[model samples]
Structure formats: C-alpha cells, structure tokens
Target chain A: MKHNSYFDGKVQSLELHTENGVATVGVITPGQYTFGTSTQEKMVITAGSLRVKLPDQDWQTVMSGEFFVVDKNVSFVVEAEQDVAYLCYYF
Target chain B: MKHNSYFDGKVQSLELHTENGVATVGVITPGQYTFGTSTQEKMVITAGSLRVKLPDQDWQTVMSGEFFVVDKNVSFVVEAEQDVAYLCYYF
Candidate 1:
C-alpha cells in the first residue's frame, strides 16, 4: 500500500486515474523541472516554495497550502528554492 | 490559486503526469469505489480506512499510512466504514 518513491537525485511525474479525471504529484528539488501542457489544471503546494514559469507570463511563486489553476494550455517549469514537494491534480 | 474540488456529491478521478509514471488519488465515501486493472500498483492511505476486494484475493483492510501493492492486474473495490480519504500513487 505504501511505497517510497524518492526524487532525491532525479525528476519524476505522477499520473493518476479515475472516473472523473486525473491527478499528478511532482517532487522537485533545486534546479529540477516538471512540465505540463494542460490549459487548465489544479496545483497544490504541499511543501516548500515552487517557482512557476508559465507561458507568456512572468514567474510566479506558489507556497504551501496555496494552489493555482492554469487557464491556458501553457508550458510551465517548476523550480524549488529549497526542497519542494507538490501535488498537481489534473481533472 | 487554490480551488476546492469537492467530492461530497460524486466521485472523481485524479490523473497525474510526469516523466516517471502516473499517480492517482481517490476519495471514497461509504459504498463508493475506485477501480483499476493495473498489475503492481502502489497505494498510499492518506486517511480513513479502505476495504479492498482484489481478484483471487481475500478482503483486506487498509488503514491510514498503510499501503499495498497489487501485483496482479485485478479489479478491486474500495468501501469505507465511515468516511475514508486515501491517496493512491502509482509510479
């Protein structure tokens, strides 16, 4: 039931499935990246600060307990200031 | 930008994406369910208790912080005794 998928030295993507939609949780370290092309997606900051670079938009800062929905199919990069852990739920 | 996707009236599917694999988080109420046909999936119980009925397997009980890996491509049912909140991460 419980498995430890470590992202200490690498980048990984989490794909989730259900009857409604999908959700993904990404773990980003400093200088690491996670990309997406969804026009509208929900992101939750579980831990740490994440620097989100959206297409045609300036870099935005997302903190813990805060989330954002990308209204456009924008390519974004997630960078961690320290050690960032996030849960990106795509419906 | 945090949006609350409530499942008080229905069931939802969470689809996650990354370079590694997909992870899904399902929230099941009493008598609700989430199904899958994937062999060898990692599941994490964030909260509540989930009763799992696997193929060719006996009924199993999964509680908070306890997860199991279904090593065979089997259909399973998740039922809650009270109210169960779980995070199923597949990678």
Candidate 2:
C-alpha cells in the first residue's frame, strides 16, 4: 500500500491493488482542488459528494454511491462543500 | 484530515468528517489484522474483499459494496488475500 497526501494534507489517499487495477481510497476536505491524471480514471464517491468539472464537460454534482470518469492526460476540477471520500481506479 | 499508519504502515487511513459521523477511508495490505473499536463501527468494503470475523460472529466473506457492523469496544479479525480498501464510520 502507498500513502499519499496532497494539497498541504487537505487531501490524502491510500493506494491499493485490486483486480480492477491500481486504486486509491481518499478523502478531500471542504474546498476546491484541481487534479491531473496520468491514466484514465473512474472515481466513485464513497462518502459525501463533489461538484466535478471534467474536461470539456459542465460541472456536475456526484453524490455518494455515484461515479464520474476522467480521461487520461487531462485535468479536472473538484469542489466539496463537505469532506468527501472517494475510490479512484486507474486503468 | 488525519493520516494514520498502523501495523508498520501495512494499514493506512485518512480521516474525514461526514454527515453521518467521522469516517476514515483506509487500505489494508494482503494480510490478517485484528482491530479493536472504541465506538460502534460500520465498515464498507470499497475496492476488494475480505474474510471478516466480528465479535460473536462466524467468519464471513464481505465483498465490494457489502458492509458489516461491529459493536463498540469489540475486536474483530479481518483477513485479506488481496489489497482491500474500506470506508469505516465510527458512531
């Protein structure tokens, strides 16, 4: 497992390998943040919600048990009014 | 966010505040671990699966999207054959 903390520790993730591929379960504090992806990503909201603006798409609210996709080599924006927990799978 | 590493970093978690209560998203490396809870815990498997033995219960398989509950002050054993990511809510 790999532990990663970003945005001055406002965001943190713990990495794990599953049958789906490499995945991280992380938490984001209440704030806005931008993230760049090295591979195609599928993000699942495990707890709370997020307002996500993916590349070339309008901002959308993703709630708990919902998910969104982010393409590789692109950047996206995420805003949280409350702490959000997510599972991100890289493919 | 609070970053916690246990069992010599074999297990790691990031704490987050949620509407339901305080929660932590964590990953456990392939192994067996016993944990004692201070509060009632609801554990949801997010990435992989595990064989969990809660207090006064038989060992059972908990898969992704499945959840198990443990009473406060009880200890439980979890065995993961592969990396497992989980969301634990303390109430």
Candidate 3:
C-alpha cells in the first residue's frame, strides 16, 4: 500500500488496487487545493461534499455519491467547506 | 484537523466534525487489526469491506454502506481483504 500526504498533510490518501484499475481513498480538510492529473481521473465523493472548479468550467458542488471526471494533464481546484472523503480512480 | 496513524501507519484517519458529532474518515489496509474504543462508535463502510469480530460475537462481513456499532471501552478485531474505507462516528 502507498500512503500519500499532501498540502502539509491536510490531504491524505491511501493507494489501493481495484478491479477497474488503481484507486485511492483520501480525505480533504476544510480548504482549497489544486490537483494536476497524470491520467484521466474519476473522483467520487463518499462523504461530505466538494466544490470543484475545472479548467474552462464553472465551479460546481459534488455531493456524496456524485462524481466528476478530469482529463489527463489538466488541473482542477477543489474546495472543502468541511471534511470530505473521496475515492479517485486513475485510468 | 487531527490525523491519526495506527498499526505503524497501515491504518490512517482524519478527524472531522459531523452533524451527529465528531467522526473520522479512515482507510484500513489489507490485514487484521485490533481496535479499542474510548467512546461508543458507529462505523460505516464506505468502500470495499471489512470482516469484524466483536467481543463474544462471531466474525461478520460488513460491506459498503453497511454499519456496525461497538460500545465504549470495548475491543474488536477487523480484517480487510482489500483496502477498506470507512467513516466512524464517536459519541
């Protein structure tokens, strides 16, 4: 298993293998962070909600059970008013 | 934000405030771990699954979206075949 800590540990994730591909379960604290993807990413919210702003897109709220996709080599901003739990898949 | 690492960092959690109370979102590695609680806990599986052995009870599998409760001052054993994501409410 791989453990990742980002933004001075405000965001953390654990790497896992899933049938679809490699995935990560992570938590984001109450703050905003920018992420750049190396592969096409599908991010699913499992707890709380995240306000996201993708490149060339308006900010949106992704609630629990909702998901968003980001193209490879793109950057996105995610804001968490409260703690948010998420699972992200890389393809 | 509070971060907890247990079992030499095989399991990790982040503290959060919920409507019900204080809670933690965490991930369990693929192994068996023993946990002791200082407060009553309701653990909800959010991803993958957990096989749990509560005090004086037989082992049971709790899948995603399912929950199990444990009283305060008790100990339990949990096993994960894959990385399992969970939210635990403490009261």
Candidate 4:
C-alpha cells in the first residue's frame, strides 16, 4: 500500500504484490529524472517511450512493451518524450 | 500536469498526452471502488487484473493487456484482486 509521488508530482507509483515479487506501476511526465534503486529492478514500458542512460551504457530508447533492467545500488537517468507508463519489478 | 489521487490515496493517476487524446495511467489497490466519468473512457489493463461492472453490463474481469470502455457521464465499479495498473484514454 505504498503510494509514492516524486519530482514535483510529475512521477507517481503504486506498490503492487505479484506472485514472484514486489513490483510498482508508475507514470512519468515529459521530463528527465534520476533514479536510484536498492534492489535489482526490471522496468517494463507499458506506454509511451523512455530515453534511458544506464550506468556505463549509452542512451537507449525503450518503447512500449519493452523492458530494461537496472542493477542494485545503481543510479540511472531517464527522459520521457511523452507521458511514459512503466511497471517495475523488484528483485 | 494533473496528479489526482483518490480513495484515500489507494488510487493514483497521472495525466498523459498521447497522439490521439488525453489519457491517464493509474494504479488501483486491492479494493472495490466506484468511479464517475465526465467523458468516454477507454481503460486498458496494463498489469494485474480488474473486475469491472459497467453500466447495464455484467461484472467482467479485464486482464492484463485488455481493455474496456465506459460511456460519458456514466459510473462504473472496479475491483482489484492484486494491484491493478491501467491506462485510461478519454474521448
């Protein structure tokens, strides 16, 4: 029952329970933001697209129905060209 | 730039801009709630599942990647077993 809203309310998330693990479904407005994670996160793009720059990796555009993973304790940058909807599973 | 959270923060949504129309990406906790709409809405389930009862329609379960529409000025009931993530487009 975690409802976290950040970045001036431009980004918001709802905690979810899954069979495998804990996940979050969130939405991001058109902007760039940095994120830090405590656990390995698998982020799936459910709508729109995200321009992501992972650690030591080039910027990549993740589209809808696509997914990307961020290592635990890692920080990343993401830019949304449009309103981006994502589901992130923590492991 | 609308971030509206309802039902004691159990439900949250972020306004989105799409090519076709305005949409909302939101998440519902494990509860039953009634929603009133001012415009026609096309709700798409992106993750988890939702039990929805539209006007004059039976209680229907909408799974991930599925969708349902509600007429303008109508009200509907939706229940989530787990956490339900949805994208709603308004027309």
Winner on lDDT between 1 and 2 is 2
What global local distance difference test value does model 1 have? Answer: 0.57
DockQ (Cα-based) for each candidate? 0.05, 0.93, 0.43, 0.53
Question: Candidate 2 on A1-91: residue-level lDDT in tens?
Answer: 6788899988888889999989899999999999999999999999999999998899999999999989999999999999999999999
How far residue A37's Cα lies from its native spot in candidate 2, in Å, is 1.2
Quality class of the docking in candidate 2, CAPRI style: high
**Model 3 - which docking category?**
acceptable
True contacts kept of each: 0.00, 0.98, 0.27, 0.51
RMSD after Cα superposition, model 1: 11.3
- Candidate 1, residue A57: CA error in Å? 2.6
RMSD of each: 11.3, 0.8, 1.9, 1.8
Which pairs clash in model 2? none
Query: lDDT of model 2 at residue B47?
Result: 82
On DockQ, the leading prediction is 2
Top of the candidates by lDDT: 2
Report the alpha-carbon TM-score of model 4 versus the true structure: 0.89
- Chain B TM-score for all candidates, comma-separated: 0.68, 0.97, 0.98, 0.97
lDDT of 3 by residue, A20-45 (tens): 77888788888999999999999998
Worst 10 residues of 4 chain B by lDDT: B12-21
Q: For each predicted model, how many residue pairs clash, with residues at least 3 apart or on different chains?
A: 24, 0, 0, 0
